[model samples]
Target: MTESAEVECVVVGAGAVGLAVARALARAGREVVVLERAGAIGTGISARNSEVIHGGIYYPGGSLKARLCVEGRRMLYTYLDRHGLPHRRCGKLIVANDAAQEAELTRLAERGRANGVEGLTFLTSAEARALEPALRCTSALSSPETGILDAHGFMLSLQGEIEDAGGAIALGSPLIRAEASGRGFALHVGGAAPMRLNARVLVNSAGLSAPAVAARTEGLAPEHVPQAHYAKGNYFSLTGAAPFSRLIYPIPEAAGLGVHLTLDLGGQARFGPDVEWIDPLSTDEIDYAVDARRGDGFYAAIRSYWPALPDGALQPAYAGVRPKLGGPAAASDFVISGPEAHGLAGLVNLFGIESPGLTASLAIADEVAARLSEAA
Candidate 1:
C-alpha cells in the first residue's frame, strides 16, 4: 500500500462552491488542498447556465436557498467591487404577458419582499414597456437587485484567494473513494500517481457528482446521500445585438424558471435553460450539445414577452446540466449536510445546489465552515 499523505483539509471539486470552501478554511489558518477531477476548475455545473446574480425572490420562505441567496448576492457585489472583477448590476424584470399571469407577478413580488429583497417594483404594461421599449407584458415585477457577473472571472478570483492563503489546488486529480480513518478520513485519489490522503477535514463539494461521491465514502450512511437527478438546460444565443438592456423573464414554469433572456457582461443576449431531465446514472456521460432545432420553440417563448423578436435571431449557443436532488414534478432546496446529519465528523456534503448557486456561493461556504466548526 502507498504511504498515505496527510493534509489538514481536502476539498473535493474545484467549482465555485468548492473554491469558496477552501478559501474560507485557508483564511481560518488551516492548510487546505483542493482536488479536481477535471483539467481545469469551474468546469462542472458551475461553468454552465446563466451567470446571473439572482435576487432571493423565488425560493420558499425561510429556506436555505432564500436566506443564502439574499445574503450571498449582497456579499458577491461587495467582493466583486473589492477585487475589481467584471460584473454589472444590470437588474431583471419578471413579466406577465396576459392579465391571467398578472397575479403570478404580484405573488413573486410579495415573495421577494418576504425574502428580504429590496427595490422590487410592480409595473404596468406601459410602465414596463417604457423601460425596455420592446416589452409586450401586461405587467411586470422589476427586481433591481438581480444582475449578472463574469462567472469565470469570479471563479478566478476565488482561486487566487485560495492560493494566496497558502492553499493548493491539484488539477486532474479525481477522488476515487474515501473511508473513515482515526479522527479524520482517508481519501483515495485516482490519477497517474494513484495516491492516498488522510485529511483531518474533508469537504465533498463535488457539485453534480456530490451524491455519487458521498456514496463512495466507505463509512458514510447510505441514506444520508440523496438521490441524484440531472436536468440538462440548453441555451440559444442571440445572433445580433440584444433587444433589451436587462434580463426579461416570463412567469416561471413548474420545473424551472422558464426560458428567459439573460445578457452576459459583453452585452450579448442569450435565452434558454429549458429543463430536460435525464437519468441520474447517465449524468457523468450526459450530452451538452445545443440542438439548433430547439431554437424554434425559443422563438415563440421569447416573442411572448418581446413581440419584436426577429426570426432566425437565435443560434445554437451551449448547454449545461444542473445537479438536482429531486426529479421532475418535484422541487428540492439546497442540502448542506454536516456531521450531525450523517454521523461523519470532519466531513460535509452539499447536494441539490442548482439555481442561485453562483449567487449563494459565499454564504454556502460560510455555512460549511460553521458546520465543520460545530463538528470540531
Candidate 2:
C-alpha cells in the first residue's frame, strides 16, 4: 500500500521559478510542499545558461516577460541586497555590426523605453568603442540596468524563505500523475519514497516538463496544454582574459540573443547560447552536451563585434535547452494558465518560461499567487 499524505499546496519543480512560487505561497500562509525530480534544487534550466538579469528590452510591451522582468529585476535586486547574495550590476551593450543593423538598435531602444526600462542610452560606434575598446560596432544600445547574478545562490535563498515559512522541499520526488480530487488535486509522486498526496492547491512550474506534467493532469483539457518545443543553446568559455568588462551582444537572431559575451561574478567571460533547434524529445532524452565543432560558427559571430577574438580561445562550456512553445522562427510569450483559462480551481501552470525567467521569477511568483488567491 502506498503511503498517503495531505498538503495545503504542492509546487512541482524546484527551479528558480518553482522555488519562488513556493516561497510566495508559503509566505502567504499556505502550507506548501515543493517536489523536485532531481536530488538537488535548481539543477535544470535554472542551473544553466547566462545568469544575466535582463533589462526588459527584448520582450513585447505588456507581455508577462516584459512586465515581470522589469518588476522582478527590481524585486530581485532588493531581495539580493537584503539577503546579502552575490550579484553585480555590470550592465550590457546590444551592438550592431553595420549601419543596416543600427536601425534595429533604435527599435530596441524604443521598445525598452516603452517597457519602462530606465538607464537606456543610444551609443554611436565611437561611443560604444570608448566603453569597450575591443568592441567593433556601427551603433549600440546600452542597458545600464542589465547585470549578472549568482543563480544558484538566488534559488537557495528562495528555498530558505520557503523552508523558513514551514514549507517542505521533497528532493528526488517527481509527480508521476495528478487527478482532480474533491476541490483539490491527488498527486502521485515517484522516487525512492513514492507516495500519494492530496493537495488543496497545485502549481505546475515544472520548467521543461511542464507540458508533460499538464498532460498527466486528469482534469485539464487536452487543448489547454500547448505542444512543447526545445531550443538548445550552447555556451563556450573564453580561453584567455576577456577584453570587455561588460556583457556584449550582437543584434537579435531568429531564436536567441545571438552569440554574446557574458561574465560570471568571478569575472570569467564566456560567449554563447547560440540557438540550436533539435528534434522534439522528452527532457530525459534531450542532449546537454556542447559540440566543439560549433565553435566554428561562434568565431565568426563573436568577431563581428569583437574583431580581436582569437581562433583557439573558444572552448566547450555547457548547453541549456529552452522550454519553448513554438519552433525556430516563431516566438511565444510566457504562459501562466490559471483557473480562468482552464476552469480548474486552485491550479496554475507555467509554460514557455524561457529567458528572463530567473530575472522575472519573483514577479511571476506574485502573479501565480494572485491567480491562486482569485481562484480560492
Candidate 3:
C-alpha cells in the first residue's frame, strides 16, 4: 500500500475559484495544495469567456450572487491595480430598444440598487448615444463599475501569490476519486504514480465536473448533489473597427447576456455568447466551433440598438461553455454548498457558478475560507 501525502487542504481544480481558495487558505497560514487536471491552471472556463468583470446588477438582493459579486467586483479592480495587471474599467450600457424593454431595464436598476451597487444610472436614448455616438437606443442604464481584464495576466498574478505564500500547484494531477479515512480524507489522483492525498479539508471547485467530483468522494450522498449542466455560449467577433466605447447589451436573458456586444481592454468590438444547452455528451462531441449562420440572428439583435450597423461585417470568433445549474433563460443563483447544506464534513462544492463568477471569485474565496475555518 502506498503511503499518504499529508496536506492541510487539497483544492481540486486550479480554475479561478480553486486557485483563489488555495491563495486565501495559504494566506491564512494554512498548508494548501492545488491539483489541476489540465497541463496548466486556468486552462478551463477560467481562460475562456468574455473576461468581463461584471458589476453586481443581476440577482436578487441578499443573494450570494449579489453580495459576492458586488464585493468581488470592487476587490478585483484593486487586485489588478496591485499586480500591475492589464485591465480597463470600461463601463457597460444595458439598452432598452423600445418602450416595452424600458421596464426590464428599470427592474435591473432596482436589482442593482438592492444589491448595494451605486452609480447605476438610467439614461435617455439621446443621453446613451451621446456617450457612444454610434449607439442608437431608446434608453440605457450605465454600470460604471463593469470592466474587462486580461484573464491570463490576472490568473498568473494569482498563481504568483499562491506560490509566494508557500502553496503548491500541481498541474496535470487530476483527482480520480476520494474516500474518507479517519478525520482526514484520502484522494486518488490520476498519474503514473498513484497519489494518496490525506488532507483535513477538500475544496471541490472543479467547475464543470463539480457534482461528479462530489459524488466520487466517499460518504457524500448522491441526492445532496445536483446534476451539472453545461451551458455553452458561442461568440461571434466583429470584423475591424469599433462600434461603441463601452460594452453594450440588451436585457439579460436567463442563460446568458443574450447576443450582447462586449469589447476587450482594446477598443475592438466583439458580439456574442448566444446561449445553447449542452447535453451530457463527450467533450469532443460538444463542439466549440462557431456557426457562421448564427450571426444572422446576431445582426438583427445588435442593429435593434445600433441601426447604422452594416450587414455582412460580423464573423465567427470563438465559443465558450459555462458550467450552469439551471435551464435556459432561468435566472439562477450561485450555489456554494458546504457541510451545513449536505451534513458532510471538510467538503465545499461549488456548483452553477456562471456569469459574474469572474467578478465574485475573491468573495467566493472568502466564503470558502470562512467555511473551512468553521469546520476546523
Candidate 4:
C-alpha cells in the first residue's frame, strides 16, 4: 500500500500487543496492516522475559492491568486451547516468610479478590510447605490461574489470524513518520522497499518505542506524550527443576515483582528481574548473559521462603526491559491513550504496558478495537 491508498487500520509495532490488535481488527472484518521494525515479530519484550501469565493479583482494584489481566488471563487460556498453543496452568504461590510478610500475603489476597480474581485462597505455611516440600513460609496465597505459554508461538498465532483474514504485516517496516491526510492519516514506513501507507485508524502498540511513535504520528501533541523509561530486570535460571511445583513470587516492587520463580514448558525454573533505571535506552543490546554474583540477594530472599535452597545453584539466565509509566518512588497505572485522551481522530496509544502485557494482550486489543471503532 502507498500513501495515496488507504486501509481500515494500520498497526505499528508487531509485538504481542500489535499483533493482537491486528488479529482483532482482521476478525472484525477490517483490512489491517502491521508495520514491524524487526525482521520478525515479538523481538522486543515478547521474546525476552518469563512467559508467566499473570493472574491480575497485584494491581489496585479496577486498574487497567488488574481488570484486563483478570479478563485477559481467562481469555488467553481459551485462545491457547482453541489454537493449540503450548501452555500449562501450572498455578502459582505467593509466599510470606514471616509475620510481617504474612500481612503482605493477606493484602495480596484481598486485592486479588477485590479485582475479581477467582479461585484465590490463603494457605498456612504448613499447607504451602506440603504443596512444595522445599517451600518454607509463614503463610501463602495460591493462585490457580497463573501459568506460562510459548510467547513467540502465541504471537505467531496472532500473526496467522491477521494474514488468514486478508491482512498483511510488513516486516522490517519501521514507522519513520506519519502525516495527517484527508479524514485519515499517511504513514511513512521504513523498510527494504521504503513506502508509505494511509489508514483510517492507527493503533500504536510500539512497546518500548511507543512514546516516539505517538510523537511522530500525525495530529498528535508532543507535550501529551509521556516520557518512556526503560526499567531493566535480569533473570537467573536453575540448572534443574525448581523445588517448588508452582510459580513463586515475592511481593511486587515499585516497578515490578521482586525476583520471582517462573517455569517453562519444559518445567525448568528461572528467577530474577532486579530493577535498574536506564538512561540511554537500547533494546537491541541482547545481554542474555547474566551475572551469577547477583544470586546473593536472591539467595537471601529465596532462603527466607525456602531456606534449604542449595547455594550456587541459581545461574544467570536472561533479562528484559519494562516500558514503565513511573520512575523511582512511584507506581503508575498503565496508560492506554485513545482518541478522547489525545483529542486525535482514530488513534490509540498504549503506554506503560509492561509486566502483565503478555497476559493482557488479547483483552487489551479488544479494548483498543472498541475505542477505535467509536472514533472510526
| lDDT of each candidate versus the true structure | 0.90, 0.93, 0.85, 0.85
lDDT pick, better of 1 and 3: 1
TM of each candidate vs. truth: 0.98, 0.99, 0.97, 0.96
Model 2 TM-score (2 dp) = 0.99
Which segments of model 2 are wrong by more than 4 Å? Answer: none
Residues 1-376, candidate 3: write the lDDT tens digits: 6556889899998888888888999999999999987888898788778999999998888889999999999999999998789999889999987777899999999999998887899999889978998888889999999999988887788888999999999887888899875586888887655678888889999887787788888888888778777887878877788778899989877677678888887777888788778796644366778888888888888887778878788888888888777767456688988888976688888988877888889889999999879977
Please report, as a residue range, the 10-residue window in candidate 2 with the lowest summed lDDT.
Answer: 278-287
Of 1 and 2, which scores higher on lDDT? 2
Q: How many clashing residue pairs appear in each of the predictions shown?
A: 0, 0, 1, 0
The model with the greatest TM-score is 2
Over 206-265, each residue of candidate 1 has an lDDT whose tens digit, in order, gives 988899899999999889989888888999988889989999999999778999999999
Is 1 or 3 the stronger prediction by TM-score?
A: 1
| Candidate 4 lDDT over residue span 1-376, tens digit each | 5444568799988999889989999999999999899888899888887999989899998789899999898999999999999999999999887777888888989999999988999988789888988877788899999999999999999989899999998888898898865577888877777777778888889998898888887678787799877887888888766687799887776777888888889888888788877755455553555566777788886676667778788887777888887887778777889878877788888998898999999999999999888876
Worst 10 residues of 1 by lDDT: 276-285
Residue 299 in candidate 1, Cα distance off native in Å: 1.2
Tell me the TM-score of model 3.
0.97
In terms of TM-score, how similar is model 4 to the real structure? Answer: 0.96
* lDDT value, candidate 3, whole model: 0.85
